[model samples]
Target chain A: MSLVDLSKQVALGIDIGGTNTKFGLVNHRGEILVKGSIPTDEFETPEEFIDALYEKIQPMADEYCEGKEFEGIGVGAPNANYYRGTIEQAPNLPWKGVINFADLMTEKFGKPCKMTNDANAAALGEMMYGAARGMKDFIMITLGTGVGSGIIAGGHLIYGHDGFAGELGHTIVKPGGRKHWSTGSEGSLEAYASATGISITAKKMRAEFPESVLNQYPEEEIDSKTVFECAKQGDPTAIEVFRYTGQKLGEALANFVMFSSPEAILLFGGVIKAGDFILKPAKLHMERNLLPIFRNKVKLVFSELDEADAAILGASALVWEK
Target chain B: MSLVDLSKQVALGIDIGGTNTKFGLVNHRGEILVKGSIPTDEFETPEEFIDALYEKIQPMADEYCEGKEFEGIGVGAPNANYYRGTIEQAPNLPWKGVINFADLMTEKFGKPCKMTNDANAAALGEMMYGAARGMKDFIMITLGTGVGSGIIAGGHLIYGHDGFAGELGHTIVKPGGRKHWSTGSEGSLEAYASATGISITAKKMRAEFPESVLNQYPEEEIDSKTVFECAKQGDPTAIEVFRYTGQKLGEALANFVMFSSPEAILLFGGVIKAGDFILKPAKLHMERNLLPIFRNKVKLVFSELDEADAAILGASALVWEK
Candidate 1:
């Protein structure tokens, strides 16, 4: 009834990462109208970073949302707390200490803003627009440089008491097993299931198989992509690397399934590009570990969202969610 | 208002256990006006059990709710599906297959009925009347013959897509370590954290220390209670058993904390009777395994509810919750 067309309304989505910070203006139907990117470490302080983000995004908003209402802002960042609206001690971020990200964004843009961790944002995006549409209970696992997760139960993101829940990446799968590179926690899902972990596995397994295509690359360069390509070329060692990674992932998935009993577990980010090389063994081990009541029930599917746009879309989805 | 006094309403609470079935008429203040129990295995079928339960509880309900309104029925049973209102494939129950427990109760009593697994009922009890009275996010662990768990997040039980959620007991803590006696799952939390697991530890550790008081008891007769008694008498072997059990429990608790950042974790049933011996090490290991953000925040406490009355109280809480 008002002058504004609610359907044409757009949200400003921001994804802050270690290397780069991406922002986009997105419509209600998960369409990105305009987007921009900036190096994350270009600014020394969070204040400077906010100013830079505003400089880029404000002009885009003016051009794209001429007839539409701008529906505030939503941000996804590492170590972000939904309850506190702050990013606390993110190891990868340029800014250290607790950054009052939402308040700062709200202040600069003169609009309300909501923020959550990148993993949780991905879950929101999936719930609203992607594979998890109409699903009430599910887990979104991001298998990137580091493993990350967001658990959705009863159609709500479980932010927990402190809004720091759903750290499945840090949940120990192997007690006293592989030590995490940064956190120092032994046998975390991140140590075995992440892209970094896959690379580590490839490097270790390749040592025993000099004939493998994985040996063609130097130890430092033997990453998940290299392993995937080698596996595609019928390298036994590379195949075994993914198989082992999947086994660890599946074991952790079994633990997660038993915890919340989600309808599905959606895998996201770079590592899933390995396709069935990872999914097959992950599914097999997950089934092997689950109890009879839970076995063969939970769907383990890949994310339908494009990796490049997912972060921005997921961040923007938070605005609509609020 | 009508002639009926809402403040004086009473609920019928039933706890269906493997060995015995207990029922009570509980008031709003969690006071049991009348209570009774019957051997669970005495009846061949669920119908017979229900009829017998009805016969015993009907007169008590009449006496207890003489001037008050009876506020339906709430039941806590093994493998109870809250959404389906059924008990499915409970290994210990005489009722082999899926029994429409809530439906049967409703039809028999001519009133509304709700049902959930016993552990979940315990959590409800804690939320309504015990240690977790004002807590919105917490986990309830019942360490009886077998470990059982009920997770409460945002003040609602996570029933998940299926009714069977919060099965933390069966979650693997020490992957490929100790094998569960019944479920045959290896290194489950129940296999290490339960009273049965404690006895197993006690029996195994007692062999290494022949001079310890634990050796006084026959291997077949050794149980959690026996270990607790010996530990109290300063038997090193018995003390080691509790420490080992606590270590395993603590490690699992750390995993749970990372999954759902609850404010507290309330432990119930027989194993907690070891008190500080179990609690101290459990707290230590849980803290040791946790990431910095999660450390020292989660309270690991014993259930404040009287174990004898907890099941009935918890069951009755379902009515009020609804």
Candidate 2:
């Protein structure tokens, strides 16, 4: 009823990471008009962090959104609760306890704000702008430093009753298997399927296989990227590392498949760059473990969103979700 | 605007089991006015089964709905597909291959029909008429001859992309632990959590623990009921059987909780009769496995619906869901 053109609206998207924060002004068509970053750990408090973000982003919003109305602000962060609009006890983040993130953002920006966990935001991004476009049901698993997941069903992201659903990374895959380095939870998917987990595997495997190319690198430098490089050069032990990682991932994927029966499982982040070394075994074991009804039906694919801009895009997508 | 009395509407609910087919006329308030059953295995063909079902149900419908309008027919069967409205390759059911169940029901009854798997129906029943009332997110696990599960997220039953979602029973818990009797899948939740699994555990544990009261029972007679009786009589081996089953069930439950973050997990069927013998250990293990944020939050409870009327009530829930 008002004269303001809703079609020319733009949203301010913020991706709050432990090390760095990315902010962008995005249009309705999923295009980022302007973007910038700030080191997240430099701030002593959340208040300081918000001030720093506002200083950098306010000018960009003013410049890029001259004729357009500001839709709102959307944020993605570790341990962020969509229901409570707070970040609670995020191990990776600088914050010590629950921070009323959405309220602070809304107060500073003078606009409505929405927030969810980073994994869930990424899933929303995938659903809106990436491989899962038009898909009503799908799961997004990010195999970065730590494994993270977001589940979507019936064209909506599953926030659970607590706004903390879809913690597939924390789901125990192997009972009494590997001990997680940080959480102390044994046999969780994060203990084996993560980039950190892959590095641990590489170190252990290289110890057993001294002649392998993985041994050529220093213990500190040995990681998923080095393992992938070695596997590309046809190193047997390096290839074996990915096979083992993929087997665990596949077995976990099969369990996930039975739980949600998503049309496809989209893998994202650094570990997915291993390509066929990981994908082939993951596909094989996933199919091997699935029931006859589920077998060969679920598609396993990589995210189509450009990795550099995905976080900002994912955060922005949250604004347009409704 | 149609002038038929909407408040007096009733739905015909059918629960097709492997051994018996139970049907009832249920009102909008989840009250079953009349109910009856027929042997499911006696029929050679699905057509004969449908004819027999019609013969018994049509008269009940007519008597119960003298003034009330017939809303629709709702069927809960093994391997029933909500999307396709078909029953495909159900091992327990007499009919083989895919039977167009919903279409056949509509043609025979001259009413629109809705269908879903029995587990999903039970979940709907629990949501609408039982313990899960007013709960948008909960899981219903049926631990009878086999473990069956239905997941409800955001107040709607999760049918997945293919209408075959929420098969928590088939999700691998033990990895390489136990072989299933029929499916041959190794280490599924069903292999350890079902009543059949309890019997198997009883037989296995009683062998290891010689001089236990479980040793007195014949191998064939040592079912879940027998185990419960022995446990009540202070038999350690029988008690251990429940503990082991509950441990496995709890571990799998933690995985489910992580997947959907349901507020409550409602346990149904014969296995729940073990009471604290299973509940205590299950609670302990489920809590132990969950991440710090999820611990001690999800309420694990038993189904509130009377077992005798649950199936019929659950089937009727589908009709009123919209």
Candidate 3:
């Protein structure tokens, strides 16, 4: 393809994780034409990481945008500030301080750049091209290493006064029940419903049920994925872990439903991979807890995007939306 | 005043309580020019009650509107539907079924009419004339016979797909703790933080401490007001009742702060009259529970409107907003 023709259309989508940095050149429709990744933890500073990412992505952008328009870059990162375009005190990221990520991307790529917390990006992506397409009011919850959320009300993402609205994961699901390791707050939903939560459940279950199938694996090896695998094989202990997690999640979602009354709540991330095992229990508890007006009104579904491409597409949707 | 001139400047605001109905003609500045009331329980039907209200309010509206403008009529009632203008299955109201209240008001008064549940009206009132003026995002919580909430996001009340969003009072504050007498849901905030909840707390405290000053009053007479009186006199048990109520309320508000990240949370209704007794503990617990990003950022305050004029003014705000 000719360089002039390649410059006619496309955007750069980037997802920064604690372990990896994934980037892609995507079309307006969210199709990734080219992609690459780098080890994020290897970088000593955000500037070094950006330099490495630019080196890897430039050739792909050059190849894809030779005859197309070069749209802006969109980034999804932990603790990203959409309004300020900085990543602030992200516990998981190797970078220790506030990083002007969007500005750096704009400077390096010679195009406009925007950034939002990963969950918000996922919500925007779903609104544009995933299950939430055409829906004005919905909540996107990412249940990965930790729980994160983005709320859409009246067709707009609710970024309250400090650009930190929609932190549903921290809302108490079981007040005074379990203490969150980091915040030390009792009964935060993240303590009982996230991937880490599943592992914690496994540990507790292991101590209580010594003869269970989960006992076959070393305690450290029994993560959410392992539990899902065991549940698929009909292990009672593993199944119980998901049941407890779903019950907590469902009850929390019911509270959320009553609070915001969203049209739907879309679940995304690693823990959701348990599929029907988690969904069935969640639906049951949510319906059981909801008031008559909200009962059965909210649709709870897993994300529709392919896991590998979801982050890339989610980031790219920001550019398309603008 | 001339009839045409009266028709150009005023609106009628009506508040329908279970025992009595208060009605008034209010000006654009939220001043009540004239007011009247009718016993609600004496009426056999919603139609009859509405008819009696119209009969009482018509004379005052006519007398004051002789040379003024009558913009519209606005009603605040229990279980009101903003979209359909009906009151549905309000447990406290004398009316047994759905009441087409706004439509009936429009037909009887010969003016455009709008209706919303009392809490929502309070939120709109605050937005238009009270503490929330010029604020786009805030939560108005009415701490009355029962807890109620109205959420404003991006400068608009969030009436969800079913016109019944912002039911924060029903959100679970303590999972599996207290059962709501009406909904049968365990741990709902209304079960702990409302005026009735405070009375309930007083009863428990009275039993636990036989020497409590609250025991002087018969169980039936130990309402929130009596408890407040006792608390002001430094009754330990009475003060403890308010402390616990404030703790529950503060914890729930903290969760809400995380979910929506509002700039402030404005409290209204009877229980708020306790002032620093409730505000102190609520602020302490709310700040303690908040995540680092949200900590100390939210302003928690009581509504600034006068109690007598608030309901009427709240209803009148609907007409102006519309």
In order, candidate lDDTs are 0.91, 0.92, 0.87
Stretches of candidate 3 off by over 4 Å are A1-11, A25-28, A51-71, A107-110, A320-322, B1-11, B25-28, B38-71, B104-112
DockQ of each: 0.82, 0.86, 0.61
CA error at residue B139 for candidate 3, angstroms: 1.2
Backbone clashes in model 2, listed as residue pairs: none
Tens digit of lDDT per residue, candidate 2, span B190-266?
Answer: 99989888888999999999978998888889999999999999999899999999999999999999998999999
Which 10-residue span in candidate 3 chain B carries the lowest summed lDDT?
Answer: B1-10
* Model 1: per-residue Cα lDDT over A1-322, one tens digit each: 6576668889998999999999999998888999989999889999999999888889889999998899889999999999889999998888889999899999999999999999999999999889999999999999999898999999989988899999999999999999999989999999999999998888888888888888888777899998998899998899999999999999999999999999999999899999999999999989888888999999999898888899999999999884
- Output per-candidate TM-scores for chain A, rounded to 2 decimals: 0.97, 0.97, 0.93
Instruction: Give the winner by DockQ: 1 or 2.
Output: 2
TM-score of 3: 0.91
Task: Candidate 1: list runs displaced more than 4 Å.
Answer: A1-6, B1-6
What TM-score applies to chain A of candidate 3? Answer: 0.93
Per-residue lDDT tens digits for candidate 1, residues B131-211, read: 999899999999998898999888888888998889999999988889999888899999988988988888788788789
Q: What is the lDDT of residue B166 in candidate 1?
A: 91
True contacts kept of each: 0.75, 0.78, 0.64
